[model samples]
Target: MENLTLEMSKNTNTLQEQQLKLIEGNFTKSEALKIINNVVNVKINFHKLQRLSKIEGNVNDKCTYDNSRISELIDDQADMKSFLRSLEVNGKNIKISSTINITVEE
Candidate 1:
């Protein structure tokens, strides 16, 4: 019911665990992407990589331990502000930059 997917590849063993470790080791997104590509030759974006690492790296685990908690994620006001600031002020949002081109392929 959760629509989960199981992507099988040759070197897919314990990949998320290694990715979580790389994230814990404070490697940047580009660094992680390059390492993954160099090791296994996968061309995944940083956003997808972040999804596998967000919980351990950036998220607080206090909400899950609470029984009567309203939210499962760390979505407090300060967290939201910090998230927005990272997206806007950090200047790493490549999607909004002017180098993107939209051309139809026929």
Candidate 2:
């Protein structure tokens, strides 16, 4: 009974360690920001299209009329890229220092 209890305790500790490692391994901010940015962009694009359609009565017409706004569009794209780059850099710094431990019962 003593040996059995010792073995059970050892297995429990190993299981706890593995669970901790698994949780740590799953902790990430990289993909999360990517998903958030994608969602925000989609929502922005949807609203922009809707507003443009309401203004011009046709989506194609709005695009053609806004042809001179190419510079503004380019600037927006640049800003979005900059924001995403910053997010990625910050996420990398945070993830790198995070520690994880694993143990296995033999």
Candidate 3:
């Protein structure tokens, strides 16, 4: 059992060792807003399309999850917009960092 555990520990598991730095950049306030807003809008649009597809495909299936997500993203956008607005300096740079971690669920 000890040897088996040691072998397993030595093995390289790609699925468990997955991490990607998706976005890392510094930009002006307007540039940061544009980049962040574009990403959020894409997510919202994706959910909207999914909800529409579900509605058209099934009569009884309601897109509660997608609707909730869309609403949440919209609220996040509003909050971020307000926060970005507070940075009045056009020359000041905002740093954006995003990381993605992938895991397998049982």
Candidate 4:
């Protein structure tokens, strides 16, 4: 019994981690916009799907949080476009760095 307990404790103590440098580069304004828009669009679509699923299941039609996030992303996209447009040269390069970390919860 004691040996089994020790083995279980050791297994529980193990930690798993994953990291990905998804984006790291300098790109022109148009390129940056495309990259950013692609990522943001996926996130927006995911939330929209979640909202639709909930509504279909009769879980909740409002999905207030998801709706709010969709609005925020749309607004952010507008802001980003404005910022990019303000850049003096279309050839100017912008640096973007994104890291994704995945871990198991204890």
Evaluate model 1: give its lDDT.
0.33
Sum up the clashes in candidate 3: 0
Which is the better candidate, 3 or 4, if ranked by lDDT? 3
lDDT of 4 by residue, 31-62 (tens): 87887788789988998988777668665455
lDDT of 3 by residue, 65-100 (tens): 536788999999999989998886757678887766
lDDT of 2: 0.44
Off by over 4 Å in 4: 1-15, 57-66
State, as a TM-score between 0 and 1, how close model 1 is to the true structure. Answer: 0.18
Q: Which pairs clash (backbone N, Cα, C closer than 3 Å) in model 1?
A: none
User: At residue 25, what lDDT does model 3 achieve?
Assistant: 69
Runs with alpha carbons beyond 4 Å of true place in candidate 3: 1-13, 57-66
- Please report the TM-score between candidate 2 and the true structure: 0.30
Scanning candidate 1 in windows of ten residues, the lowest lDDT window is 93-102
lDDT of each model, Cα atoms only? 0.33, 0.44, 0.72, 0.71
Where does model 2 exceed 4 Å of error?
Answer: 1-27, 57-106
User: Pick by lDDT: which candidate is best?
Assistant: 3
Against the hidden true structure, what lDDT does model 4 obtain?
0.71
- Positional deviation of residue 92's Cα in model 1 after best superposition, in angstroms: 9.8
Please, what are the lDDT tens digits per residue for candidate 1 over residues 37-104? 34332222333444455456546544233222223122343453454445432424222111212333
Query: TM-scores for all candidates?
Result: 0.18, 0.30, 0.72, 0.72
